[model samples]
Target: MTPLAIAEHAPLFIVLNPASGRGEADNARRSIESACAQAGREHHIYQVDRHRRLQPCVQEAVERAKAVQGVVVAAGGDGTINAVAQATLGSGCAFGVLPQGTFNYFSRTHGIPTDTDEAMRVLLNEQPRAVQVGQVNDRVFLVNASLGLYAQLLEDREAYKAQFGRRRWVALWSALLTALRGHRPWYLHLSWHGVQRDIRTKTLFVANNALQLHQVGLPEADAPEQGQLAAIALKPLSTLSMLGLLVSGARGRLGEADSVVSFPFESMTVRPMRGHRRVKVATDGEIGWCAMPLEFRVSPEPLWLVRPAVAPELEATRQ
Candidate 1:
């Protein structure tokens, strides 16, 4: 299929979450408009704010794109992108990103650039490409989803982002503070790749994208491993040990530590042995409680996303 340029392509629709990136997304409206104007692309841009909900608006835009076989762009952070991506799933409409989020993990993992204008330029010029997608129950996550300490830390981290505001450093501080203040551990039963295991740990991290792991200081597989990797990480023995994990993680020495057990699988199912009706879960920086006996699986079918022509190795090879 021939790649569509922004100016001559079918109608383009963009969903912008104003709450994302600490009001940084608010200015994205003008940037997108300017970029589209420069490209002479006929597009509609929607802004999601406090009063109006996001899903319905995004759903409408995605439907319009599908009807016309155009494109829908999620111009916010990971959470916003999650909602928009779900809407675009199996719709046959091309999906694009602007990466106006704190980590922009999904965008970066797909080889989407962080710079707004550059990302738009890529979107305006490239074709949609296939990339793996992970699902937790019915919900989809582009980066990761986990229970145990990671979920609790994510909940706390959201609160900090709500109060102190955005950025990776804020999340880092929140995780550090949560560790230092003391976090309880729990037992989990996990079944994956035809094996079952019981483990006691503070955080259980199910990873789909390794790009962000490098940001936090963990060494991923030398070559591209499976799209879905599972790591059950134990908490620090003490506050001082938390510091050690931080330093070691940054240096990509986490595999050498006894605190984490890592494995690769096509998919996995996690059940908390504890008698809780719902378990706290974190998917791509979005924190929420999900019904127990969570099932995670990979969809090799891929999410059709727009990236630069010269995409990175990770995004370029999935198809």
Candidate 2:
């Protein structure tokens, strides 16, 4: 269907996470409403009060708005977007983003405007486009799924942020430094695009698209468009080497590091060494401690999003 077709039929459901971006939902909602008024599109604002409650809210809202051609707009960061997108999969309800959360990785990758008014204008005026989604076991992720030290850092960062309001990167760095002191190599056995391989590494990331690793002065780019996943493995490095990798990443040359390896895959399964109890896993920026033996796969055509005009041309090229 054409962009105009989708807009004309769908009554937009804007889901705002008030806690995102340090409690900016009230301002975001007003701005969105103003944009809607200007565009003459009907919209309802729903605030997500809790993290796990998002799926049910999205499901119910989509069901209610189904007759009107529902489009669920996530007005927070990647976590909020991931939640709504996961629930709306295969439901024929297009997902839109307002990018109100910190480090909107999904929005940044897709070139969605971070500004509330600009994003709303794009949502009202842009076309709905299909994008691939990644699935690790039962959960859906729009950006990437990460395991190992980085994931642990994410878990810790969230906790620290809640307790102390420290910046996420600073918290992550502190956590990683602490975690690395006790870190051990993990065994990752997997098959990607029918090729079998094994690697023992300290960090493993399976990304739906390439991320401009912060502090690395590299041009930002999407993952390959073959609908395959990109995997990065980092061998255990000395504390100094790890810090150097961060520095190099900031300089945008992670591929140049001998400790980092990246490749493409269609799907894979990851398991930690035996007797490991709680390995960290993160989808988007949300982190959790999970048991070993997690299954991951690339879900073809799992989400439809409204793409802004300024978004990278590659998003428009997706089949």
lDDT of all predictions: 0.76, 0.72
lDDT of 2 by residue, 74-93 (tens): 88877888888887777777
Q: Write the per-residue lDDT of candidate 1 for residues 126-195, one digit (tens) a residue.
A: 8787767878888888788887777888888989988888878888899888767777777778898789
Kindly provide the TM-score of model 2 when superposed on the true structure, using C-alpha atoms: 0.87
- Of candidate 1, the 10-residue stretch with the lowest lDDT total is 216-225
Best TM-score goes to which candidate?
1
Model 1, residue pairs in steric clash = 149-202, 217-249, 217-250
Indicate the residue-level lDDT of 45 in model 1. Answer: 81
